[model samples]
Target: MPLLFLLRLQHIPLPVRVALSEEVRLVSVLVATGLIEADFAPVRPTGPDAASRIATVKRITEEGLAEIAKMSDAPKFAKTSMRFARGLRLM
Candidate 1:
């Protein structure tokens, strides 16, 4: 989910950004609780090839977002609490 936030803040490919956004919406509660986890593999060129390594990084990011969605949901209590606070002008 932090990846999603960073993607939204940077100039990245639209499709990748959109995928991240959708994943974030699907797992916002885990994000709010700071429970999302992402594994960033180290980049190593196998045969003087760098482009494929970059693609691997992108794929890893997408997979991480998918895992987050599968593990989280929007927390109902947090939403309701925020609404109640706003009603009292304490937000």
Candidate 2:
């Protein structure tokens, strides 16, 4: 699910993705393996709204897709497979 989401959605914020079911663990694993970088610090909001804080968070690396292709458990659906194939093109 996380893999598919990542494939379809570009520039997704890390906090928002973690709110998805079971994605926190998946994202953590991906981050640990250098597939994703979570070093982004969201822009601090002047207002007290929590939503604004969440909206500012983001994390990514240039090689995110390529790293996903190297994973053994990459998603198998056609769309995801096609993306993975493309990701592997430069390898």
Candidate 3:
């Protein structure tokens, strides 16, 4: 899988600015919702065998891609990619 990149364009409210842990929770929720699939791991390596992680989006289900496309086509989400994605960067 490719690495996800984030760009901070401006300051969003504290409520909207989700922490890494919260973002991971949201990704787990998304996976539970069947919209996408992800692999979870520690933010910082705990051991030599530990893997780096950031709730990587290993793959998007067909439904997930369709939903994303639908979101982009919508008026509200068209220009708000980051918000629409929550904290996960789409590939």
Evaluate all candidate structures by whole-model CA lDDT and list the values in order: 0.41, 0.49, 0.52
Candidate scoring better on lDDT of 2 and 3: 3
RMSD list, candidates in order: 10.9, 11.2, 15.1
Sort the predicted structures by TM-score, highest score first: 3, 2, 1
Model 1 per-residue lDDT at 31: 35
> By summed lDDT, which 10 consecutive residues of candidate 3 come out lowest?
1-10
Clash counts for all predictions: 0, 0, 0
Across 5-77, the per-residue lDDT of candidate 2 in tens digits comes to 4554355535453433255445555566665654323445565533221221145456776755654354456
Quote the lDDT for 6 in model 3.
14
lDDT by residue for model 1 (2-87), tens: 54554342344433322233443433433344443322233454554332212111323444455545534446657888889888
How do the predictions measure up, each by TM-score? 0.22, 0.38, 0.44
Model 3 error, position 43 (Å): 7.3
In terms of lDDT, model 3 sits at: 0.52
Q: By TM-score, who's the top model here?
A: 3
| Best-performing candidate as measured by lDDT | 3
